[model samples]
Target chain A: MRIGELSRRTGVPVPTIKYYLREGLVPHGERTSPNQARYDEAHVHRVRLVRALTEVGGLSIAAARDVLALMHEPGRGRLGSIGKVHFAVQAARQPHTDEPSESSVARTNDLIEQRGWHVRPTNPARAALAGVLDYFTRLGQPDVLGLLDDYADAAEKLAVAEIDTLGGRDVDHMAEHVVMMTVLGGALLNALRGLAQESAASAKMT
Target chain B: MRIGELSRRTGVPVPTIKYYLREGLVPHGERTSPNQARYDEAHVHRVRLVRALTEVGGLSIAAARDVLALMHEPGRGRLGSIGKVHFAVQAARQPHTDEPSESSVARTNDLIEQRGWHVRPTNPARAALAGVLDYFTRLGQPDVLGLLDDYADAAEKLAVAEIDTLGGRDVDHMAEHVVMMTVLGGALLNALRGLAQESAASAKMT
Candidate 1:
């Protein structure tokens, strides 16, 4: 199929599809001629995944590229399926920390594990920002690092509640919103937490 | 109070407080002498808000600046208190869309009224992301917008369930986690939705 058919089938525009191709998100289609390229079912699958990440997951192209990289790894399983979300959330958690090292992420993970917490390795969110933990740690702010486990523990319940929340919607709408909320809602959670901290200070007076 | 006393109270370092002042996040303290700056309760409040926005909200300085602009307004009781959250959530719906015009947002409210979809503005997340509707309309995409609302409705139910799931931790931790989940959980929600989409597709094939 040409790009138009792929766009019609995927609900993405031809120009945007071309952009994704240029970005190397979707794999190169087999060229039937010097000017024509042919797409297949794999292209269709990749396009849907791309939509899920960009439109629904709210990832930037670069971030989406990282996610696709991990997804392309052999035998990633359900672990790979959920990895990008994890890396995204981790990036959201410590955005200013900048590029962290593998050891720093490992250190934070170790700290969280020491506190008896559970976080999925395959989560793409952690993978994407895998660098920030080290950078932030180098800043010598242990307070944020200390909160990692508690953050994860809090996150685990929210994830379950979020899934449970999906139960009542029409299946089609439910699926898309679930993905959107997962990304957008995660940001809201952080805002709510900040306000709660302020409220706590005010509440102390009472 | 002296800077030392303020530091003792807030557990924030003197240098960090000075940085906050330089950044214009906190108002300057009264200068007692050539070298002395005397702070007060107002400084304390402002500093706390700044720290909360940085650490907990994970907002970039510019993003935090935009949010604080709405917050420091005297009329925050109405606009600042909750409406800001609503607006922020809406503004935040799409990662890459530019800051929208007031008229564009108004146009969205008109669409919601036209659709006659049952929703509430009681809370921002509850009624937030009407900006998403406009984006969808402009893009000629309803399936995605419809899914966003559906996700919100589901999340409302899950919020209640999550509260129940919090089987009596300290109030601060509970509140913190609630906030954390609000943001992080949304990302997880997206992953779930995508997985569901994949499942649905696979089922059709099978």
Candidate 2:
């Protein structure tokens, strides 16, 4: 298949595909002639993955590129690969300017200790969580803070369920599966939360 | 206090404060003279809210403005206000171009019905959920689809916990609280999930 067919199959425009190719997001197609190149199923898969990351997952091209590069690198143990992907995705989503206060960081550490979660100290999610706690503190909303344990409980359950589903997967597709479940799974969970909030609010009203 | 004082208090820069005033994101302070205007706590609060929505919530300027406007509106019951806010936030976050397929829409509806959730059909989350399902279908990941019910269970639990925390709040502050929890809570939940995934992955590895 040529670039045209690749575009057709993926529903991405030709110019956008060229731009992705230039950005090294999608690997270059085979050189068939002076003016033509051929793409394959791998090209289609790569294009779709890139689109899913940038479009649905809302990662920047640079971030998506980094994730793709990580996916292709071999010899990282399963835990190492998962940790790196989590770090990459979480770091990309969190802004650098919002420094979490020492108090907020302490609160986050306290939560970790209470939950006995074995996350690394430098995990980006720790800072991200502290950032939110800091924001709530600024807003003077203690009620929201009181629900932290419940949120953690829900998060732990979902995480365990997500990991349980990973048993017996083909090693060849594990990286891709991890990326999809991490990125798209966040979106899916958020969407479901929105719907559930609506239902809960309505149930409270009447 | 003057505009400079307001800027100092909120930690928003003077020029940015002026821009917010011009954008009507923050109401104008009373003019003390031709050269000066005095701001109060309300102005300070509005500026902070706008920053939270735009910076922390990742809403566009237009979306932030809309949410601010909703925060000030009167006479909508608690559920109505909550519903509108959820709709606005979800609609703003989801792209208009990604139309959900019929099958995905059916799947989302089935989940809602199975859960006996009382959300409206027009709720943007329904479409957002369907969009994610469609993306998963395109990626050919049945492993992910199998976890939909688990995701919903987690979402439902969190939603109920959040709403339960809302009892006895002053009516005047309810709108602001809802907006903050809905937006910042999503960020908080996502961050927590990331941490939990790390812990779960590590536990499995060991």
Most accurate candidate by TM-score: 2
Model 1, span B124-195: residue lDDT tens: 422224333434444333444444444333444344444443344443233333333333333333333333
Question: What lDDT is reached at residue A24 by model 1?
Answer: 94
Q: List the residue pairs that clash in candidate 2.
A: none
Model 1, residue A41: C-alpha shift (Å):
4.4
Which residue window of length 10 is worst by lDDT in model 2 chain A?
A75-84
Off by over 4 Å in 2: A74-79, A95-97, B74-79, B95-97
Tell me the TM-score of each prediction against the true structure: 0.47, 0.94
Candidate 2, residues B103-186: lDDT per residue as tens digits? 999989899999999988788888888988877888888889999988999899989988887777866677788888887888
Given the true complex, what DockQ would model 2 score? 0.68
Task: Please give the lDDT score at residue B121 for candidate 2.
Answer: 78
Native-to-model Cα distance after best TM-score fit, residue B167 in candidate 1, in Å = 20
The number of clashing residue pairs in each candidate reads 23, 0
